[model samples]
Target: MKPEDIQIGKLVRKTETSSPLVECFDMKTNTCPIYMCCGLKGALSQAVGAFYGALDRYTLEDVITSENRAMLQHILLRSKLQPAAGDQDEVPDLMQGVP
Candidate 1:
């Protein structure tokens, strides 16, 4: 399937700014606040890293390797959607930068 064809939760009619981060709505439940719910985070991060690396004219062999792509796929598979019960709480860990 194409990248766009891959359903990472819902597209969320509202599109945020261009970056590694993307905001999506949980169609399964509407009461949930705006939170990160997509499976494309790892892949998106790698892509951004690559773009910046290229723009800076860096010649690193491992930057765009197949292993990096596989890592992204793994992250997507491991991330499961578990709804939040009770009040809307903020998760500070989600704000951490990519390693």
Candidate 2:
């Protein structure tokens, strides 16, 4: 599908994306003792609304522009052409710093 027609928020939701940065924001999983009067919950709720609002404003086309598309395509093609540095099942060296 064309990037221009993709609604980011809808795409994310369709994939069941989990924005789990703030654990307390999830009503089903929330176990905070101060559920009734927590300022963080109010702030996080607003943040989540703002997040989706921003997502709704743009399509995938907004992120991958005409100029960047060529570069991205080149990189994608190059990656496909090259053999992997190590075992196919193993993590790449670039991410060795990660746990």
Per-residue C-alpha lDDT of model 1 across residues 1-99, encoded as one tens digit per residue? 234232222212112222223333233444425345645655766875665555444222224356575675566447733323342432222112223
Residue-pair clashes per candidate? 0, 0
The segments of candidate 1 whose C-alpha lies over 4 angstroms from its true place after superposition are 1-21, 24-37, 58-99
Residue 8 lDDT (model 2): 74
Cα lDDT of candidate 1 equals 0.38
Candidate 1, poorest ten consecutive residues by summed lDDT: 8-17
Candidate 2: what lDDT? Answer: 0.60
In order, candidate lDDTs are 0.38, 0.60
Q: Taking the tens digit of each residue's C-alpha lDDT, what string does model 2 give over 17-96? A: 44465767677888878878877877877887888888989876677766777776666456642223442432222211
